[model samples]
Target: MRFFALWNPFVFVGYDIASKQQIKETVRELYSSKPHLTATIGFSFAGLSAALSGAVWTGAVATLIVLACMMFRVWMEHHFRARSSEDVGEKWVRLFVFGSLLSGFGWGLSGALLLYGTSAETQAITMGIACAILQGAAGRAYMTPGTALINISLVIGQMSIGAFAEGNYIYVPAFLLYFTFLASFIQQMVDNRLRQLNAEQTAERLFREITEKNELLRIANERLATKAYEDPLTGLANRRKFDLALAESLAASNDTGSTISLMMIDVDHFKAFNDTYGHQSGDECLQLIARAIGSSLAGRDSLVARYGGEEFVVIVRGEAPDMAIAIAERICLAVRLTSLDSLPSAPPRQTISIGLVSSRAGTPETREAMLAAADAALYKAKKGGRNRVCVHRGPCPGQQQEQDTVVPFDAAKQA
Candidate 1:
């Protein structure tokens, strides 16, 4: 019974009967892609072989007939396209059976008519080729057992008839052995159909799971990358990001023969503000200062980053002497305007002391040198009193020069 079930081409062995409609749909979809192309090539090759074998007029007629049938099937599909899926499916099943019947008849006719009275060599060559073509049809038509079995009956059955009718002693045994091969071939096709369907389902499930996992991993990596380069407190670029941006800007400035500036900004008397107002209030002060500085450089190609406790760095491209001083003044003004009176004893207004340095295109200075120069200017601002902007130009020298300029705004004067 197992062998019989395995060898039976008549049984439509697919998914369970409960999923009959789904099976039909799957089979139809599979057939839709390759049938027309297969028909055209198969018929053309058969017709050409006949024509070369000196049956020009008959071959032409046969080729035209095959082409007309193929075109008719194409028309059949389009005609039933807008109907309900159930109706379309029924039509597809019927159309496929009819197509198989037509092609099978063509091959059976080739065997019945062409093999009559031919020599043993001609018969072998003719029927052998026909059997090979029928094997291919079996594979292509296996989605519907009725279609494949009908095609197999017509084409292979005709060849069997031809083999015995020739009455050559060797011909009958030759066909019997060939028939055994045919049984094995049909068994394989039936088994392969089930295997292929199962494999497709497994692949789809695995693919869906893999896609979900990949998306989650992509989100995790993005979060890790963001936290690495961002300051947690003020929501600005961290010092590491600041250093990278400064390096890139310096390289660009060198290529364009322009100046790129780095400004070191420190909250004036920040330690005193924290001591009097508490560390919580001091954090609020830093956040407000960062917002002000970011707002000051909003329209320019500038980067402002949190550079450690109560310190910030700003990188700007172009001439820095005038621009840096102006940006620093704007930052000081923006911070001073913010009202952060969380406690009674807090200072009336917060101010930042900024030291700015311009990296000239020809200057022999690195990013660290620019920071050091800006730091020197910041120290000068602290020495000359707080609430000020100072500019330091030229190379990164060890000593504070007399050419550095300071714009001091006294807390008493602002009040």
Candidate 2:
């Protein structure tokens, strides 16, 4: 009873590893045996059977059985290889198990046919050959322990039946003992392999988790970097980015002996506009004006930034004083024409005043001096009447007695 229980296919089904994993392992092991290798094994068994039994008929029958089994194995291997790993399941496993059974039956029948009417010495040699085949099957099929147990049982059963019918009861106990040891060895092998597979699966899962966390961290860093240098409200370069750009442009101007044009712009009566409408409308107005200014300067090599509340700044490199004035004029008209339909509670049109300063390469104008000059020009534009463009040509270090040359253009007069 214990001998039969040992060979039952369900004996190892309670292992921790999944049945699907076992199916994949079995298919992989089976396909690893190349067609030529299987052919060699089949021909060797047939050739040996004839040599030991001295019966060409038995060898011929063995050849037919081996060829039939080999062809089925080749077809099965092709079918498995063509399928995706995810698609492999119990149906395929059952098919493979059936094939293994067929193969074991064929080999066992070959052994029984070889043993029939043979001398006792020939019968002993035949049993030894059958044992060799059983050991080889166990090695090949141990990963799917159930399949291995089934094949071992079928092959050993036929071999034992042949020995008993030939009145060789003395060899029965030896076969039984050998079978016991082989079954124990197979069980140990299956346990070891399952442990290895479990370890590998755990390692793979950890690797994937680490990889996903790294990808998410990379994306968050990119967003943080962008926010560091960008204006959250307007999606424009903020003051920090503007400072860096101006410093780099100033260095480039020093090298190229070019002029650096700076424009400081302020929306006219913005405080009054905010007071008339709510803060929400003030935000909408600023967004609209920002879009107008950005559109006006499109395709120009320039950087525009919101300097502060109701104030914006622009830096244009390598342009003449007249070119700077033209750019300021464009900005004034663009802002004036800006549609306030999005802010229905606001006025029909809004206007801006721009203060321009052009610093030549050899000038000793520092960053602070240029900004002060632009601010003074903006003050001059307000004094000259709002909605005008003003340029400052004056000394860098402010002296109370030194009057700045203010060039102011009224948009209405120019029109």
* Residue 9 accuracy (lDDT) in model 2: 50
| Whole-model lDDT per candidate | 0.68, 0.75
Predicted candidate 1 versus true structure: per-residue lDDT over 63-111, tens digit per residue: 6765665666566555545456555345555555566577666666555
Which number leads on lDDT? 2
> 76-166 in candidate 2: lDDT tens per residue?
8788777865555566666777777787787777666656656555565667767777787766544566677777777777767766776
Error of 1 at 182 (Å): 2.9
Model 2 regions more than 4 Å off: 1-64, 71-98, 113-129, 142-145, 177-212, 232-235, 248-261, 269-285, 298-302, 316-324, 338-350, 357-380, 392-406
Candidate 1: 10-residue stretch with minimal lDDT = 1-10
Give the CA lDDT, 0 to 100, for residue 50 in model 2.
70
Error of 1 at 246 (Å): 2.3
